[model samples]
Target: MAYTVGEMARRLGVPASTIRYYDKEGLLPFVGRSSGGIRVFTEKDFEWLRIIECLKKTGMSLKDIREYIELAMQGDETIARRLALFRKQRTVLETRMAELQQTMDTLDYKCWFYETAAAHGSTEGISDLPDEALPEALRPVRERLRAAAEAETEEV
Candidate 1:
C-alpha cells in the first residue's frame, strides 16, 4: 500500500525532515514521488527506511550507506559486495560496543561509589576500600584506572 511522507514518518517514529534528507542524500533511490512532487512511500520503502535507520544507528556514515544502497540496487550480482559492507560494519560496531561497554562499566562503578559514600555520610577513605566490596563486574574498571594512575606516577 502507498503512503505519504508524513504518514510514513509518523509510522516510523522519525521526523519527516529525516526522510527528506535521506531522499536528498540519494540514500532513498527506491523511493518514489507523486506527479505533484510529493513523496510516495510504500511498504517496501518502510523496510528500506528501517535498514537505513539500522545502519545509521550503528554508526555507518551517510556516504557509506549510500554506497551500500547503490550496491543493493545493482541487483543480485552485487550480493557479495553488500555482504562485505555489512561484515565490515559489523566489525566496526562490535569494536564500538566494546568501548561503550567499558564506559558503562566505569559509570556503574561511579554510581556504586557515590551510593556507598552517601550511605557512609562521607566519601572519605573509600578509595582505600578493598575490591571484595565491589560488584565483580566493576573490578576490571577499577584495575584499569589504578593502572593508569600508576603509569602517570611513573611518568612523573
Candidate 2:
C-alpha cells in the first residue's frame, strides 16, 4: 500500500523530517511523489527505510551508507565488498559491547567495595584499596574526568 511521508513516519515511529531527509539524501530510491510534490512511500519503500534505520543504529555514517547504497545500485557485483563492510561493523560493535560490559563489571565491583567499606565504618584511608582495585580501563577515564574538573576549577 502507498503511504504518505507522515504515515510512513507514524508507522516507523520516526519523525517525518527524518524520512524527508533520507529521501533528500538518496537513501530511499523508490520514494514516489504526488502531483503536489509530497513524498508518497510504498510498503516496500518503508521496508527499505527500516533497513536504513537499522544501519543508522549500527553507527553507520551517512557517507558509508551512501557508499553501500551506491554499491547496491551496482547490483550483485559488489556483494563481497558489502558483506565485508557489514562484517567490519559487526566486529567493531562486538568489541565495543565487550568493553562496555567490562567497564560495567568494574563499576559494579567498585560499588560493592564502597558499600562494604561504608557498612564497616572503615572511613580511615582509601589508599589500602586492593592492589587490583579499579579496572585499568576505568582508571584512565576517571583520571581524565578528575583532570578536567581540576582544570575547570583553575579556570574559575
Best candidate per TM-score, number? 1
Backbone clash count, each prediction separately: 0, 0
**Highest lDDT, which number?**
1
lDDT of 1 by residue, 1-156 (tens): 999889999998999999999999999989888899888999999999999999999999999999999999999999999999999999999999999998898899889989999999999987778999888988889899789899999999
Give the per-residue lDDT digits (tens) of candidate 2, residues 1-156. 789888999999999999889878888766778899877888888788888898898888888788787888799999999999899878878887888876786576567557757977884654355535655655555555457789999999
- RMSD to native, candidate 2: 5.7
Residue 27 displacement (Å), model 1? 0.9
In candidate 1, the residue pairs with backbone N, CA or C atoms under 3 Å apart (3 or more residues apart, or in different chains) clash, namely none
